[model samples]
Each structure stands twice: as structure tokens, then as C-alpha cells.
Target: MLQIIVAMMLFFVMMFGIGFILNMLMKTTWFPIYLYLIVLLPLGIYYTWDDSMNFAQNMGAYTIVDYLPAITALAGAYISGTAIRSLRRGGYKMF
Candidate 1:
């Protein structure tokens, strides 16, 4: 549906912008990926966790619409790191 596509694009753009800024500030290429894995991923899981439901039930609740946004966000994080790395390699000292 249109909503799913919108959500995916929104998540991707938000992650990319945040990651880009973080990379510039931290001067690290891969920090966004670590932050996404260590922080965002666990927080998302915790938010969706259900005490009454079994692990399988909780995990099975996710559909393509849910997973797509996550995938796009992760891709955004990775691409942001690559972009920074490319800039650094290209002799862009500001990046």
C-alpha cells in the first residue's frame, strides 16, 4: 500500500540524515551502523516485545510492511557510512 512505501521512505531518509550528521560530528564512518545495531535494534525489539505472547508469536507479528522499513533504515545507515567514507577518501576534510 501507499502507506507502507511512505513509511519505508520516511524511515530511510530519517536514518540517513541522522547518520550523516552523527558521522560528521563523531568523525567515524561506521558509528551509525553500531548505533543502529546496539541501540535502535534492541529498543525496537523491546518496544514490540510482549510478555504474555511467546517469542514466536511476538516475532511472527511482523509483516513485510514492518520489516521493509527496518531494512531500509539499516540500508540508510550503511549508505551514510559509505558516503562519509567516500568523502574522507576524496579529501573532503570537513566530512
Candidate 2:
């Protein structure tokens, strides 16, 4: 449980850091971040699978198939929130 929390926190921090940098360096459109995430997430999941498997084993019968989609949705939510903030801050033009 604790390990999972730590892993999740690390994942969020890393993703957000990257997103923040991109937002600073270029257009803050969620579209590109969305696409980047599609590529990055699978690699993240692959790297984290062992830890996830251990955590799941502790809980019983959790598969990557069962969890990946939910995690991806969570990632999307984070990116959306970041994009919304950037838009609100006038980083992006509405018109």
C-alpha cells in the first residue's frame, strides 16, 4: 500500500514536471501532451509492472489489463487539469 502510494506520487511528480517544462517552453495545448502521454505511459507501466505485480499479489489477482486503463484515465485527468490551469492563466488563446 505504502509502496504503491510512493510509486504513484513519483509518477505524478515526474509527469507534472515534464508537463510544466513543456508548458513553459512551447504551446500549452493539451493535445501534444496527450499524445506524449500515450507513448510515455506504456513505458512507465512496463517499468512499474514488477512493483505493481507485487502490490497486486499482496491484494490478490490484479492484472495489468485491469489497472492500466484506470491509470491512463488518471494521467489524462492530470494533463487536463494542467491544461485548464494554463488556459486560465492565459497561456493559451481562446479565439
TM-score of each: 0.95, 0.49
Q: Residue 46: error of model 1 in Å?
A: 0.7
lDDT of each: 0.94, 0.57
Q: Write the per-residue lDDT of candidate 1 for residues 33-87, one digit (tens) a residue.
A: 9999999998999998999999899989888887899999999999999999999
Whole-structure CA lDDT of model 1: 0.94
TM-score of 2: 0.49
Instruction: For candidate 1, give the lDDT of residue 50.
Output: 90
RMSD vs true structure, all candidates: 0.9, 7.0
Best by lDDT: 1
TM-score of 1: 0.95
Clash count for each candidate, listed in order shown: 0, 0
Query: What tens digits encode model 2's per-residue C-alpha lDDT throughout 1-95?
Result: 66656666665566656665555556554643674557765665566566535765644554554464446545744675566576668755541
